[model samples]
Target: MTSAKALLLLLILVNQQLLTADAELISLTTGAIGAGAVGAFSAIFGTYSYIKCKFNECCDDNWIPGNVAHKLQQEVDEKLYGQHIAQETVIRAVRAHVSKLKPSKALVMSFHGWTGSGKNFVAKMIAKSVFKKEMLSKYVHLFVATLHFPHPEEVEKYKEQLRSWIHGNLTLCDRSLFIFDEMDKMPYQLSIFLFLSNGGMNAIVEKTLENYHSGQSREAITYKEMEQLIKNSAFNEGEGGLKTSRLISRHLIDYFVPFLPLERRHVIMCFKDYLRSRGFPTNADEIEELASQLHFFPKSSPIYSVSGCKQVEQKVDFLYSDYVHEHYKKHFIDDL
Candidate 1:
């Protein structure tokens, strides 16, 4: 080959190599630039998914589950209103539901009324009798939100925060319960009224953690609120931190609800005691006398309970036909 021809071939080869390098660089650049968007996408999607799943059905919107509602209904049937029998029934049913490998939403069953009517004491008794691990394990993964003294502002703040966290962090679950005690105090609570009535609403647990953990804000929820949150949201659905929580929260609840199945999760809530506690009784009743009449003991003076349909039918019949609206609005309506 002549020198000129050889030089021409070398030039052609160098040009080919340059072209290859340019193509490779372009590919790398494209990939690099796309990485952040891809990550951001995954992060946002993950966060959204996490939020929806983690809190989709949280606390049955922070109220009693169907099973609990069912039991409460039964109590009402038996005229067990103004009694913790309804709550006890809920505990038993919750336990039954959990034992079946079924998990439930976290909820706050606000026990309210005139101060001193033994509502709180009744709640405690109801918890003891119905919320035993053995009972709740069967159906529910319990979460309790007992307010020490939830003022209206505090209630709204927590509710807004909770809704934000759920939207940003939580996911839907088949079943959970959030028992909000003293909701009457926080007249502006979300998901609570709907809960007792068995309706759907939203809450967000992820934003709650993010605002809290990143020092963007304090873990603003106080000890009482936190305890209730932990208890209610005992079955958290994420690895940790804001990002992961956001990613997994929504899907977590969604994932759980399907496998768990709510067909069997009928619930009810009951109101038996007409007051808060003996010391805080409604009306001008003598403390000791009112407490005595209220049956502060586990076993009632009448021995056998107002058993079965007779008791239930009577109470419900009256509430539904007689004065159900007034009953809830006036008698059972929590003072918060």
Candidate 2:
């Protein structure tokens, strides 16, 4: 037991302690690396799952899609000129329905009015404003009754097909909009038609031979019949009632908006709007002069446009062209 022996023992203990420390450090470093590897693997797997779900049917493209209420309000306020009440009602109804937690029913609106009134225009506006891609959305369906159901004998078949179409679309997406135009011309049975009124190449037109007395009639359903038909199609509770149309009963009719005939003032406003959209000057004098040229019913009838701006754009085009020609004559050509 000398000093040298004691020193050697101390050195051995020191070396053993250093070895233990190195082993502990290595263990800690390995644990950290293992945890980092697990995290990396988890991140890669999560990203792949996300991409797959996005590409597949797991994610709906239009789930809680656009701010429909705001867009509708904006569209109506900006685009629709002389229908304040109609515009307001459309915005309110659309916003309310879209705001619901789970809207069990579709908003059914009936637009009725004279031929050239803004019924179809407003209907299309509603559809476009509600969806992100507007009318192009897969959920929006436009059906013109006169275009869809020409043959009266095929009414029942149209009914079944309509029902199936509605069911199928709703199944795919509950937020679908089915817009039926030309309700005034619809058959009493609430079915479908082929639109022959367009005068297009594909449209069906009635012609009478001088030798033959037989021809297709263009008789429209009376207003009373139209009312009954609408009630039967939209409000009936079940398919078993006296009113057997389940399409309307199954879906809720949110509003029945009637487009009243446009007065001369409304027509003037439409003219101004059209002018502004076309980047033309819409001064009071110009609108009045243009309005005077439009033909109204009852030769003395307060100068109202019965066609409700139907011919305004074309008339404007003609007027503008004349104006341009006159300007050239007054300035460039006359100077020469």
Candidate 3:
């Protein structure tokens, strides 16, 4: 019947759509798989033209293409930096962060900053291009930046399992970098993180002494302890979190609360619009001086404004947005 033929055609179309979506998902996760027998299959798909099945060629589609992994490799190889500052900066970062490291052991460098500053995009490009090349791969061990969560309710891990992970890298016996992308969001930057990322053990020195209080815990943390803490504090949901049947809860903010340093407080104010609301300091001070120095911060706006910590805590959207709009307007708006 004509009706039966139409139904069959519709079903076939639906199946093809599902297959396409499945393929996309696999591409997105190719960089996150474990290597084993299954990993062997992944490698074949990623690197080899298995369809050239040697003597065992068959009707099977062994010549299937790889996902984003393949595409990324091609992009890195084909990328031609045409006298752009961003490309130069990326190359500088690669040279400064990787090439300069001592060949004694593997190193890591966490490029911490706000979101949408192209951390992952830039990181992937560097790893795929610099580390995969024959000359650098011979001595400079490179890797994709890894993220670890520390406690419950947070996404990254603590210092618990970090040591063993580093110990595993010991066998490679070459200087390398394990870059951490976001450090300000973490409870505190671990010492080992600096050691692994920076190549030198003492790279964990404070960039600003103002952050440390007189009586803060000064004991150094070990890699194992950090990793163990991460493993213990896992998130668990017990039957839709018990909030007594008819109970209600509301969160409140304290006005003009005094905490943290005066400079830090001002930074938050400038960030949230509170500074503009309070008619931001007309008498120029150190904050303005430093803002100009930091590339991460935007160029001073004629119409400067800010908000409170409560409004934009853990969300550096404005800063990242301002930076992206200035530099990568066309690419920034595209759907990732």
Candidate 4:
């Protein structure tokens, strides 16, 4: 029998013998036998527990330890494009929070930027760093505002359900991660309950321009400056769910991360990366052609991508579909 089965069987046998000995215990021989049975049972139970925890997701073994900060930094550097400020802020925040033995409260960060500027991408990276199964892990919960709370009128109902869901998940695993996407679409009432959003797009763009015009490098923008701008924007912006929300009023958010608009060069990098990931040719000319297909903003300067890398995968797939079909026909259909 396998070791687990063997151990289980041995445990059952030992329990039965101990019970029988207990019923007639009095003699020294019986006492000695009972003591030995107890010892064996304890050892077998310990061994079984160790095996179960090691091979199963029943314990801390399934969670990534604090050392994952280093891995997260490396992955962000290699994979994530643009948003230098976000890269540094996230790495530092996560490293500091995870390293703490007893954090006073949950680490809450608000990512702000225009659509497709890597807000969700960074969240996924954080999830991957902390959970073995990454975004698919039971500990990771993703709730899209539009999908989960469609009715703004039923804000109270959604709040209760959301609260219960978070509590239930936390009970199951204290390390649970709850990601709320499209926070701008969520009802303002629900803002106080969760921790996520995309706000301050205009302010971010304006600040970036101001810095550039002032002869300052974009990379020199500090977290403090970006944080203040994002906070002000979220507070004053009517469309954002976080406007006047208790989370911001009470200073509950730990960091307000800004994802700068992706420039043409960054979008090109994204195209090449996607192509390489899908086993497609990373030809410089072809990649440039693919990137040129994307729409850039500010008709005058035409610097940043209008859609960022959001549509990159779709564009790449569409570009290759016909080629793939013809290649299949040539290699497989011709042989038939």
Candidate 5:
């Protein structure tokens, strides 16, 4: 049993003993001392009950036990652009997992995509929907491969520590969300434990282009088509952590959600979205200019964004620094 459970048992036994003693004392001498003893026991038991309730309710502020599916769907639809496959897969998987009274295993999703293709964005959305404090919540843990486990020589040591950290956190809050970014950079050994990025970029792009040329909507792409492609690429190509990892072999990962590369129109949408977020007017000309700054892929076709919307916010801010400052200053002065 856990330390908390042991402490609770101890408290229960002590309270029982105190209750028995108080009853005998009250029966023996109906005096001030007996009445005082009875009052003290009652107070102790009440304190114990309060402590128990607090322990149980400690995670309430961070975790919402309600239907997270609707909230997640709404957030994804509104904020996340492109990658229709990722949007649908995540919602259905999360809904099925969360709605269960007791899941057979933890919900493990491996996100595969090129940089700025909304892997991190979708992950954040999931965290925001499930966690009240989002990324700031204690229960939401994010581990970047390059930062957390950089040294390949220390793989064994990292493995032990990683296991302990995950186990301890789950003990505290089983509903915890763990996001491992840059899985492509992690040592193959560590990928056996957790699953991230750049594992299926080519497949995603090629398939997307194929769909477009076939006159199918981007949303028409199905999870079934992407799943096998992503799994194969993650397992076979590159020196990515997922390559030959037991997590893939044992099939521990629940889903390999693919985030497709963004097109010119999607990049323009991102530009407008960023501008709106900063309280700036989304002028047609300005939006077009901002979108123009980003480099797209396939020099022949030039259809998909090379960096997607990754640098959009920074680029917008850098280009319109003076305007942003003036807008904010005007607002501040008006308020005054």
Candidate 6:
């Protein structure tokens, strides 16, 4: 009986050990499953939020917030000088288009013309009006085509990548703004990827011409004329034809705004802007003097600023440097 009791006790101990091991394994499995479930839920929630914002026009980082649309119009008019009619048209068009919460198509604006004619400046204004951080927003993708794809051989690769990038960003947020700087430099075939109009996806594309001939007599074609021109160019296989010509032949360009060469008045206005930006008071006489001193190229037939407003600030700094030197020479003559 004592032996039987000892055997029973040993069996009970063995069963208890086995139960403890099973309990430990069950606890570990439950813990792992719970952790996985939490992670998955977090991912799902994040994705849902992103999709919700895209559809509702309330992207966390992209869409223009309340009152910004109106403010943007004012800022564009005030800051972008000498482009009065253009600015008004842009403001009107953008405001009207964005008022529709769900636009079926993306707003595409093509800015072409002389250098320093506010093509890029207007683009930045549009971005600022739409986003809180404006150009700095994650949703704003600025691509210089020439800088991005330098080799002709990389055209195919660039096309695929560009398409994927646009599609992926649009999927994440339809309100994405893409600035294609130097659109003229973009390989014709590669540029076709940008005009893809897939349903349920929308984005703003601003294309700027960076390599255009200064002072070329362009007829300032309207959007309709541009479309017609594309059709003719593609069908006729005309000079300056693009591989993507066929694709853009029927594409609807929302706006094809042309920037004209800056006149002396415009240059003066630009200098004032530059001075103001650098915390200098806008003195009319000083601005006029600087504008007059700016040399134009092709001395006989001048149409645009030699360097646009690009060198205006540099000129201002030089003048200030001269002033400082003169003052020092006059004050410290004895010491010298």
What is the TM-score of each predicted model, taking all chains together?
0.23, 0.58, 0.26, 0.81, 0.80, 0.63
**What's each prediction's clash count?**
114, 10, 35, 0, 0, 0
Each prediction's Cα lDDT score?
Answer: 0.32, 0.54, 0.31, 0.76, 0.76, 0.57
Off by over 4 Å in 5: 1-57, 61-65, 185-194, 328-336
Cα displacement (angstroms), candidate 6, residue 61, comes to 7.1
Instruction: Report the lDDT tens digits of candidate 2 across residue range 192-239.
Output: 111111111011011111112243222221233333333433333232
Model 1: residues >4 Å from true position, as ranges? 1-112, 116-157, 165-174, 184-336
Query: Residue 59 in candidate 4 has what lDDT?
Result: 25
lDDT (10s digit) by residue, model 4, range 218-309: 89999888988887786577755567566666877788889998888889888988898988898888888888899987787787888989
lDDT of 6 by residue, 1-336 (tens): 333333334434534543333322222233244556455545655675576667654555446565555977778867776554446557776776677766667776555444566777777877777777678876788887658877767778988898888888777566777887765434311111122111100110111111124432233323443333333333233222343543345555565554545567778888877787866678888888888787664465554575556678788988778666777798899677
Clashes in predicted model 4: 0
RMSD of 1: 24.5
| Deviating ranges (above 4 Å) for candidate 4 | 1-56, 63-66, 185-196, 327-336
> Cα lDDT for residue 289, model 3?
45
Of candidates 3 and 1, the better by TM-score: 3
Candidate 3's TM-score reads: 0.26
User: Pairs clashing in candidate 2?
Assistant: 147-193, 147-194, 147-195, 148-192, 148-193, 149-192, 149-193, 150-193, 150-194, 234-248
Whole-model lDDT, model 5: 0.76
Error of 1 at 191 (Å): 8.1
Per-residue lDDT of 325 in model 6: 76
lDDT of 3 by residue, 1-336 (tens): 333333334434534543334332333233443444355444644443353343332222232111323444454334421112223333443344333324332323333212222344445554444333322333232332243543435423443345556555544322333444322222211111221111111111221121233433322223333222222221111322212211112211001001111123334334434333433333345345434333322134221112212233224444345554655666766744
Kindly give the stretch of ten consecutive residues in candidate 1 with the minimal lDDT sum. Answer: 256-265
lDDT of prediction 1: 0.32
Error of 5 at 269 (Å): 1.6
Better of 5 and 6 by lDDT: 5
Candidate with the greatest TM-score versus the true structure: 4
Error of 5 at 71 (Å): 0.5
